[model samples]
Target: MAEMFSMLGTWNWLVLGLLLMGLELLAPGVFLFWLGLAALLVGLLSFALSLSWQLQILMFALFAVAAVPLWRRVARRNSGASQSNPFLNKRSDALVGRVFTLEKPIVDGAGTVRIDDTIWRVAGPDAPAGSRVRIVRADGASLTVAAD
Candidate 1:
């Protein structure tokens, strides 16, 4: 172990650290990130101070274990910052309670409506083209509507 440390250089640690960080891009979820960061920190420290393999390993382990929780705490605190708009991804849901004219006649609870340039399929009572309807909610890709 001592011989291995004697032979290993800070450059090796740096290379290993970079490789691990790169690997995190392929398999991501906050796992490799901490370890890779630990390796890089150890590498930097090694350059400033000569360290035995045991101390190096200890530092790496401490960094790995300690950093993640601290990061998670800060992350948890910051995440509470005005959550992303709830309506951002719910395109259909955003249309609920709004009124629009039908572009096609609804027959047996099926029809289409044009809002802007996009055509949306609607489910509601039978109505002729040009009839106004109010969106109730979204069901999958279709909207549930009622006569306005």
Candidate 2:
């Protein structure tokens, strides 16, 4: 293992960097990009001044660690520029804060509300059919509602 480290040259570092970056295309978790950049920086540093294989690896590790904070800061600053839809996959959440008539009578704190063509299970006070109810929140597949 020590000999392998000693034999790693500047070209080896560059190749390793390219290979790590290529892996990013395969498994895109946004992590390998930082490691790839680290290897590339080490290669450049080695080109300027001859460095031992161990030193090159140390520089790569340092650079990779340093890049994480920079990436997080960039993501934090840009997060508000275009807000992502938090309710994209949550269908029940979209029903909250809307008033809908009870399709079925609410007996024993259970009922159903018809929103358009879809019938959704709801939990609230007992009420007769056609009574107006306001959706307060959603719990999994059920909506929590109250009298509007």
Candidate 3:
């Protein structure tokens, strides 16, 4: 292993980088890709400067660590720009502003509404049963409503 490290060349780093990147396709968690990127950087750098194998390994380690913060910044920026759906897993949030009829009368600011075979607890001003109400807000399993 020491001899191998001592004999490290640009091609070796490049091949190792490519192999790591290829492995990422088989067992991916966005980890190996960074290491691959670091190796690739070291390989490319070796073309311009003569670095010892130990220095190359050190540069690879530095690049790999640096990639984490870079990746986080890029990911955060991209994620904020466009989101697929704001209400993907939050079903209650999607119900806001939708109008539904109250199945039970809202007495003392409490009532129940049935929406798509699911009974939802509602809180709002007193209203009679069968009255149409618009969802003003959703808090977990409870919804705040207003007479529509």
Candidate 4:
């Protein structure tokens, strides 16, 4: 093992990099790709300057660890620029504060309202049909409303 490491050359690093990168395809995580990149960088540098096996290993470790935060910073920057839908899969919560006319009269603190073709059950003070009410809270399919 010691002899093999001592005999490490530019081609060895490049091959190791390629092998690691290929393994990334099998185990689909973004980890091995960075180590592969580190190995490739050391291999490229080895062409210009002969590096001891220990120095090459150190450089590879440094590059691999450094890549994590660098990648995260770039990923965070790109993510911040993208628009995310907060209301995705949460249809009822999106209606909070929106005013809609009651389709059925509220008696005994229960009523129904039609909003965009969907009739929603509401709870609030008694109100006659056609009266406007604002959605104050949402709990699952039920809405708490107030006269608008």
Candidate 5:
């Protein structure tokens, strides 16, 4: 184990980095990808000069410090991209501003509506079944509604 650690070369480190990056495609998370980049930088440094163990460790620390924050920024931007996609996982909020007809009358502040083949619980002013309603807001899985 010690010998393997000591004998690691620039190409070997580069290969390990590529492997980690490939694994990130399957994992789809930010962590391994940055560490892989850090390892690749270490490999490039190793190829450029003969470094002592302490120097190698220091270089890795610096790479991590530089890469992690940059990776986090990119990940944050990518995650924010989903907010612009209308069909993303937002259930109730997606329903607001959409129109639906009540499948069952709203009596005592509760009823059901068929919205695109899905029945959802609704809260609004009393109305008979088949009346048009517009979703005003959403609370969890339920929608607050008003007459259309």
Candidate 6:
């Protein structure tokens, strides 16, 4: 078994890298891509030079150290400048700045407002039912409203 494992050479590493890359398609995140690149580099280096086990370990460690920070920097540059849609994954965020009519009177700073057939708990200065209110902000399932 040990001999069979030892027989795996540079080509095996290359194949492993391809497998990792293929897995990345199934689970698309930033992680496996770097590891696969490292493996591919190691395979090419092993093919070019007869590397000792210590050199192989050192190469893998160096690849990890270098690739992680570089990948993070690239990822941040790609993602940081863009504004994320507030409505993305949060449907209530779309209600901000929209106007609604109070369905129930706000007594002691709490009331309900009907928005698209759903009554949402609201907090604002005291207001009567049927008053026009604008959504100032959303807190969980509740809307912080103000007189429109």
Instruction: Give me the runs in candidate 4 sitting further than 4 Å from their true place.
Output: 81-148
lDDT sort, best first:
3, 4, 2, 1, 5, 6
* Model 1 lDDT at residue 91: 81
Better of 1 and 6 by TM-score: 1
TM-score of each model, in listed order: 0.85, 0.60, 0.60, 0.56, 0.66, 0.56
Tens digits of per-residue lDDT for model 6 on 53-124? 566657867886799899988988877555465466676788999998999999999999987778899999
Maximum-lDDT candidate: 3
lDDT of 4 by residue, 1-148 (tens): 9887899889999999999999999997878998899999999999999899989888988999999998799789877654476777798999999999999999999999998989999999999999999999999999999999
lDDT of 3 by residue, 1-148 (tens): 9898999999988998999999999999888999999999999999889999999999999999999998888889888755677787799999999999999999999999999989999999999999999999999999999989
The TM-score between candidate 3 and the true structure equals: 0.60
Clash tally, candidates in order = 0, 0, 0, 0, 0, 0
Q: What's model 6's lDDT at 60?
A: 66
Which whole-number lDDT from 0 to 100 does residue 109 have in model 5?
A: 92
Name the candidate, 2 or 5, with the larger lDDT value. Answer: 2
Which residue runs does candidate 1 get wrong by more than 4 Å? 74-82
Error of 5 at 1 (Å): 10
lDDT (CA) per prediction = 0.88, 0.91, 0.95, 0.93, 0.86, 0.85
Judging by TM-score against the true structure, name the best candidate.
1
Show the lowest summed lDDT stretch of 10 residues, model 1.
Answer: 80-89
- Where is model 6 more than 4 Å wrong at Cα? 1-8, 18-32, 44-58, 79-96, 102-119, 124-130
Give the higher-TM-score candidate: 1 or 3: 1
Model 5, runs deviating above 4 Å:
1-6, 18-29, 44-58, 79-88
Instruction: Encode model 2's per-residue lDDT on 1-148: one tens digit a residue.
Output: 9998999888988998999999999999989988998999999899999998888888988999999998899889887664566666787887789999999989999999999889989999999999999999999989999999
